[model samples]
Target: MKKVYTISEVASLLGKSKETLRRWDKSGKLCALREPMSNYRYYKKEQLSFFEEFNNHQIQDSIDIKPQGDYNVLELFAGAGGLAIGLEQAGLKCAALNEIDHWAAETLRFNRPHWNVLEGDIREISFSGLRGKVDVVTGGFPCQAFSYAGKKLGLQDARGTLFYEFARAVQETSPAICIGENVRGLLNHDGGKTLKGMISILDEIGYRVIDPKVLKAIYYKVPQKRERLILVGVRKDIEIDFEYPQPTKATYTLKDALKKGELFNEDVPLSPGAKYPVSKKKILELVPPGGYWRDLPLDLQKEYMQKSFFLGGGKTGIARRISWDEPSLTLTCSPAQKQTERCHPEETRPFTVREYARIQTFPDNWKFAGPVSSQYKQIGNAVPVNLAKAIGESIVKFLNEKRLIEQSEKSLIAI
Candidate 1:
């Protein structure tokens, strides 16, 4: 069992003043236990379990997600290793990972010493060597259009586009299935013509494309209501049906994202973070919880918004302060971007570095490497690790079922 600590001890661990800790208590950011007689604040031993996802052994076991037998994977465009870690937790062993950014590649290597992280351009790598051994090929491929130069676009025409690279990998690796994730906007990009072309491209490579679906992350126990469009494909030879993971009934809130709770075992750890300039800080203090700049005084709203104040409808993200009681707004790459701001509910500033990682469901101890701004970009671009874990579990189940069918077929053939 873990040792319980006093409020001061926890505060010391978090690097905040006792007064700020009390403020967090009042705001329900951190919950405290009261001693029966003195009514003094303290935390329980059980709280630590929520701060860290895996046990003292940082290597999260696959059995927790009910992983099937050993399964291996090759991932492309793997950023910050959020999805890869999640998949690893879900029982898939990563054979190799391709990440273009140097910082992100370093971040991956820093976290998992054993991972084979390929740090360079995707176009230069040949995946043909991995053809039969890899069970899955996954990527969050950037959405780019293949010119309808011939109207009926095929593998040859998609060569220059990122999706072409992704398809090329699929063709080379010959994995049982290929998983591609993208922004929800892809559903309607170029009036849905782009998606249609993507499907046609998959068909050209001898794979059957499933109708793509946009998954709302909140449903899978993530606090934020972010969405991603998941595109799945099966080799033309297989008749297996894929199943998506079922969502948990409970909905996590922003409070859950940042502090100690089921999502994390400890109050978030202190890390280097950015601070807002005095001018921006002063303006943000006026915004209330769950409120934006428009929630401020009329004159201040116009002053803060400038000429754009008169331009359009509710740009809710403007000068927006998140509510502790509610889910956070979808996070942007820059936490304090002027147009798509995410103000700390009570404090007149942006979320700190550790706070941003919490919102993305990264484990507290999973240190990020790079400058503060670069760290923010990496976290913002990652798929919430929890969401990826859920997807991984679902894929594992499908593969297990496929494995069983193959076994049964072998038995019948022998008979």
Candidate 2:
């Protein structure tokens, strides 16, 4: 997992000659970074499109695990039911979903009337009634720092945080397995103490926590280059191992997301979208496809970026225009936000609502219930539907194995 590569190393990795790379750099096809002290040209691991190894895992055939019998999932912090939809598609039933947001809850109830959408604060809800009925418990809890006391952090130390609620639900429901998902930054939050604390808390609650994994959405049929850190725990009594859904060899791009292609059967439906202010629009119009603030002319770059222009590190997301051939950068809670602009390749405006849904792999028919800004937040914060389905399939596989083991043990006892 090297983050920066020398030109020669990149040439070897991409199976290209140094001369060709130099030409591509000069042509702006594959930009190379220059070392500040040595001025030596290098390539960032992400800039090399042909190198799939940067995903940091072996690509395997897609998984197709089916449930052995009816399996039920109890979802928490279930914003708009993205995970629930995916799990349902993978043959698991959604027994209940608790979302604190009124709009997200309304969206879930609107789409799936049968779903038990519990709207309100998670802290006020109780899962003890469904203790043994739920096969799995899933939540995308917000990451927060826990007060440290000893070598191991306990559940009580995480009180007042959303994660505590998630852990509490897991303890109360007593499911065969539990899952927690969060942004990739969670791995390093609080200099890694936050994740370690979570692991220790799960361990204390009669569950064996697995090493967390950051699954890239691009490898799981998602058109956007999003990543989610997945934390999985198995109840101590279950001996079955849970494998992450294997990454697929296939890749997708913005074109696949918005046009009639493999990712979608029809072009993205027409819908309302955010428009850049005239001043921002003027600057972005100068940027070509796949280009960012650096692509702008010197004066415009300075004007558009302001103080950030003088800052270190590549502010590549600013004024970015996504290329049709590339997967979009991870979306934020707001598309029109200056820090992470997601401009359409050809259009000067932001992606429309339906287009945003398509990029997240939501079914075209699935509707959001909220104001335009609220809708964007729901979609942006969601686990991409296709990626969630992949995870769900893996969970189903684990449960299938557990079911078989339990059945065999019962038969042996009878004999």
Candidate 3:
């Protein structure tokens, strides 16, 4: 008989939170069977043997989209096209995409000449032409709070906010579904008041907000420890519930990112990258794979870390060398920052542009324009391609069920 494991037991043994494991189950990234009598769940250990080294097993929900179908979508705040690329891969056709950054707008048009790329401040544009025509409307809108006028939040108060532009697009597009994504911090922003205001605005617009959830990138096959909060809204008239995508197993590592593995199949292609100062490089050279400032010689650690050495808490990200065996710390805007350091495992340098893209699960063929630093910034700020793909699949699943409901109603009317 295969060894059986309880959810809590597996979570403990892996050094991960139970909620992460439960989310994996909910997303269908891992398979578990319920106990016959108690209805408690158990995972058959044999199925997870492949991940014994890392104790990381995944259960991906069955939301897969291919190229044949046409899902007309309008994307707002489309930065560097990360989400757009993922959606396109999932059979969605880009009807139009809007971005404020000049370079990101240029990058989109450069990649797809025929695309209707709207490059300007969103406040200036009108979305009236798209009403009720698109299948899905999506964006990574910056989280902003709408001032409360009465007990309920009003759309007028949200006027100057970017989310208002997103909501306005939704109000105008009237798509069957809309997806909003943001950094994990958005969940607790303004002590969670920001999110509540968003929900109220969405509700006031006739869309029912689904229970939103945060997704950890490490669980979705990306080799980086990043997190994103996703907000899904279905038109109130639609009866179907939107299920978030399941995470896949990590077939990647910092080694896979900078070197080669199941993720890249070839070592990271050479590209321009940030360089460390001679002093910082010398200190980091003493650290080993997966080790941080603590791994350095006590005297050298103090010299390099300065006053930070006296600070409380783990200070784990400082002078840390990534490991072939573990996921990377989250990427920051600047790769070589003194405090939020992301060091390469074997080398004393920082991760390069290609390495950054690989960690974000971006394909090699996908190009990044502009100077080296801007390229890193774009990749760092992006939603991981694979993570977005899983999300795209989930959106397809949710919408398909909704389409079925419409069919049922029409059939009854005809009869």
Candidate 4:
């Protein structure tokens, strides 16, 4: 029912950058109209139909297709349990989880005491014991390119990388489906050979790899503009097609995240947060909401950016302050880093630990384990819980369809 979308919304919807949209507007290709009130770029829904990528617009209401039976997932590289919790919310049980980080494993165990948290190197852990027990094998493996001599990469060739471990788990378990989650840059990492290698390895392991997709977190009800590349593979025997979840028209803003809104029942609880040094705080105060280093005074810009001021790129995240009306830029490992400063809209400080968790769509009760710095690292590195939930729903839908097909085939065999 939404007729118009802001430049940010359109960017997420079309999987294009705002800069690209501006370029299109300048060239008279998909021109944008200025909103009368704020003078911001906006596009009517009709204008988007011309693009091939705009074919799917199915909203969130219809995407929550329930599972036909109990489903279990064996999660690898389970950091802070973000994806695990989301899958749990979507009616999938965590049969087991493998996390190498001690703190993250502790967080997982602390949150869900019953969850089987295999704490140690994934290389040392064998998932062969879980063969045929788990319906899905999922992992957010860190992107690492395999060394190759122009030969097609295989499972053995990926030995040193975490992805190899993920594939090993999938092969050991022979799950009905497998998912690989990573940053969007993986598509272009090492000139796209890394991804091509990943597909080749998955195929060699007796799975059918589907084309990868970059799912913007904002489209899946997360209050951040983080984009994750999802790579799904079906076991060679599974006949059902795997479909990605459709984007929702509804979007949430920073205000919706921090304050009591539809996303949360109550205002964000105050907690310990990172602080900027006197020098950085002084410079950041000049930036307005939804602004970055570009908005600072001329002299201050040079002083703050120093050598980087002369750099070619936008450097938009420097001294950035999020606007209440807009979703936040992607969160980094540390909130107060010089390159990616996520300053509060009203206050000139990094978001509180709770606020950081909230922005990542973590529940209030989901207490993070470790020091403040470690906590930020865990929350920032996590997949937005809401986005994970949306993905979980899609997985459940796929498994449910597979279940029905198997049941029908069994019935025919009996007859």
1-415 in candidate 1: lDDT tens per residue? 3367686445323323344556778898777878899998887766645542212212222334465577878999998987898888788989899999888999999999899998999999998988887888999999886577656778787778899988998899888888899999999998887788888889999899888988767666677767889999988888887776665645567788888898888787777767777878878888888777767899988888999899966677778788776667778888877778888777777888888888888887677888889899998998888889888887888788878888899999999
Runs in model 4 deviating more than 4 A are 1-60
Q: Itemize residue pairs with steric clashes in candidate 1.
A: 50-264, 50-265, 51-264, 51-265, 51-266, 52-265
Clashing pairs in 2: none
TM-score of each: 0.83, 0.88, 0.84, 0.92
lDDT of 3 by residue, 374-407 (tens): 7888888888887887788777777667666777
Which candidate leads the pack in lDDT? Answer: 4
Poorest stretch of ten by lDDT in candidate 3: 52-61
Ordered by TM-score, highest first, the candidates read 4, 2, 3, 1
| Candidate 1: segments with Cα more than 4 A from true spot | 1-65, 149-151
Tens-place lDDT per residue, model 4, 163-275, is: 99999999999999999899999999999999999999999999998889999887778888889999999998898789888877567789999999899999999899999
Q: Give, for candidate 2, the lowest lDDT window spanning 10 residues.
A: 11-20
Candidate that beats the other on lDDT, 1 or 4, i.e. the better one? 4
- Give lDDT tens digits, candidate 2, residues 1-415: 4688787556434434455677789899999999899998888767865655444333656648889999999999999778888999899999999999999999999999998888999999999999999999999999998887789999999999999999999999999999999999999999999999999999999999977899888778888878899999999988877999887766677899999988888999999999899988888899888778888889988887789999886766778898887778788888898758999999899998998999899999999998999999999999999999999999999999998989999999999
Q: Measured by TM-score, how close is model 1 to the native structure?
A: 0.83
lDDT value, candidate 2, whole model: 0.87
Residue 149, model 3, lDDT: 57
